[model samples]
Target: MDLVIKNGTIITATDTYKADIAVEDGKIIMIGKNITQTEGAKLVDASGKYVLPGAIDAHTHLEMPFGGTTSADSYEAGTRAAACGGVTTVFDFVIQRKGQGLIEAVEGRRTICDPQACVDYSFHTAITDLTPEILEEMKESVEYGVPSFKLFMVYKKEGLMVDDGVLAKALEKSKDIGALIAVHAENPDLIDMRIEKFLSEGKTSAWYHYLSRPEFVEAEANKRAIHWAKAFDAPLYIVHLANKEGLEEVTKARNEGYEIYAETCPQYLHFTNEVYKREDGRNFVCSPPIKGKESQEALWKGILNGSIQTVATDHCPFQSYEKDWGKDDFTKIPNGCMGIENLYPYMLSEANKGRISFNKVVEVCSTNVAKIFGCAPQKGTIAAGSDADIVIYDPNKKFVVSKENMHSDVDHTIWEGIELKGYPVMTFSRGKLVYKDGQFLGTPGHGQFIKCKGRK
Candidate 1:
């Protein structure tokens, strides 16, 4: 064995127990007590710490273009932030240009991050152009190990939205090809009308951005997308689902046996529309904007129950200056939040306080994301034969989140000033100690692209 983590409690999606984890050749080789550490091999005595699978943030938009500017986090900074937050892998979107094929989209995105990422990652290709050939390309991409496709029902003028016809055809094709279709569910026409109405009335504050994209906008599109998915008897995953109305729709469909997979982000759980009243409130501006206290409570429930399966950071970042674009016109502001570094502490803090179990945190943060995105057993769990991706969490440690402590290149963090009691003290990617005690030791490009396979 090359390394041993002794006397630590391991938490999985369903099990929690103390064991010594043994690793060799970047894979877990044994997990049992009394395994003596061999000479010349590194030994980490994780006494009284919790050793959990590294988080897999299933949603992120690093280096993506929006409006006239691009998201601030590049692959190097973003993945380093991920490792600092105990995330060993991420599934970033491979946004498609109108004329690009699936394979080309993947390769182009790889050119951006392949040499800089500090953690293993994969792509969920966004299907912006729907065509017969693209439909066949979905199958080819699946054969190439990316089995998830993202389609947008909004962003009409930006050339990203697909109509109902394209959505339906994509759903049917996903069914045929064994792929999952993830959608940004929003009633774009209704939102457009609302935006025009709000702008005409001079209601151009950041709050109006939320009003323009009301909860009903998400509910209606979710219902409509599920309608098409049911028509084809297909599986559908809703990305960044934010409220009770959308959760209810997913629950109703799931009650009828539809595979209504969904995820929610920490921003929606931690902040609310009231933040728009702050001077820098515009910084919290994101599509399907965060809602009220009631919505936050409901989303927490969704996490507790089985309705919300994963907790991913939609870690799309724009610096404070980029947000000034929307100062004059709310529509012009690029939407997103910087969240890659706060994912683990936020959830683990909640778990420590009885809001959720520690095991549940591992499930939503790592295991379920892996199973849903087809990276299971390989990355989400700490069993033998799995990649030696792990985190040594110190439940007794405490820290207040601040921009100074953050690793992302962005100038600020939305998670600022929030104090938490639990955090990852050491992050191990494969068998390498990548991050430790507020510093990153891993080199860029140490992370590799994970070829994600389809659900069988």
Candidate 2:
């Protein structure tokens, strides 16, 4: 044995028990009562703590370009923050340019990420320019280990939106190639109309950003996307679903035996549109802006009722000066916030406060994301034959959220000043300790690229 962890309560998606785990060659070798320690093996005592699987963040945009400025977090900074937050694996979007192929985009992203990532990483191809040749490259992408693709329903002016015909055709191709199609559901025309009206009325404050995208705008596009998915009989995944009406559409389609999956973010669950009325409201501007309080409650209910399957952070942050670009015009502000380092800690804190069960926390934050993104037994479980990706959580450790203690490169955080009752003290990726007691131990160029499998 290379290492042994003793006296910890193990928590899985469906089970919880007391066990000692032994690791060798970066894989879990044995899990039982009182695992013996070898002469040269390292031993860790996890007394009174919860030993759980490492988290998997399936939605993030690190170092991505938007509105003439790149996101503040680099691959190294983001992945290091992920490790500090107990995330062992991340799935970032690889956006296809106007004339680039899917595989070309993947290679380009790898060239930038291969030497900087501190945790395991993978890509999801976001198609902006769909052609006959690009459609063929979708199959090549899946064969090359990326089985999920994304298309935007809004952002028509940015040249990222796909029309109904293109969406339907993409769904058909996904059905043929055993890939999942994910969409950013929002009605562009309605949003454009509302924005024009707001500007004409001289209402360009940060609150106008929330007013421009109402619940129905998101609901209508969600319903339309489900319509196309049903027409093609293919599985559809909704990314960063926020509104109650959109979730209702997801519920209805799911009840009828359609393969529809939805993921919600921490920002939507914890904050409402009221945050936009704050003094620094420009810092809270994100696309498909935060909804009302009722929508927030509805999302919590959906998670308990099994309508929402996963919780990830759409973690794209801009510096304070960058956000000031829209001090007068809400449209000029960047559309992202920092949450990659808060996903697991926030959810675990909620569980500790009795808002939900610890098992449900593990399911939403780790197991479900791994299963849906095709990293299953290798990444999301604590059993023999699985990788030793583990987190030693101190459920009673009270810590305040602040940028001073965070590892990301951003100048500000949306979660600042919030106190968390539970936090991760140590993290292990493939049996190697990377973070412990507010310090980073992982090196750059140590994280491997994961090739995901498709539905077969």
User: All candidates: CA RMSD in angstroms?
Assistant: 0.9, 0.8
- lDDT, residue 56, candidate 1: 95
Q: Write the per-residue lDDT of candidate 1 for residues 1-456, one digit (tens) a residue.
A: 899999999999999998999999899999998899887779999988999999999999999998888899999999999999999998899998888999999999899899999999999999998778888889999989899999999999999999999998998888877899999999999999999999999988888888899788888998899889988999999999887888888888898998889899999888888998777888999988998888889999988988899999899989999898888678988899988889988999889878899999999999999998888889899999999999999998888999999999999888889999888899999999999999998989999999887866
TM-score of model number 2: 0.99
- Candidate 1 regions off by >4 Å? none
lDDT of each: 0.91, 0.92
- Poorest stretch of ten by lDDT in candidate 2: 368-377
Error of 1 at 82 (Å): 0.2
> Which is the leading candidate under lDDT?
2
Q: Which residue pairs clash in candidate 1?
A: none
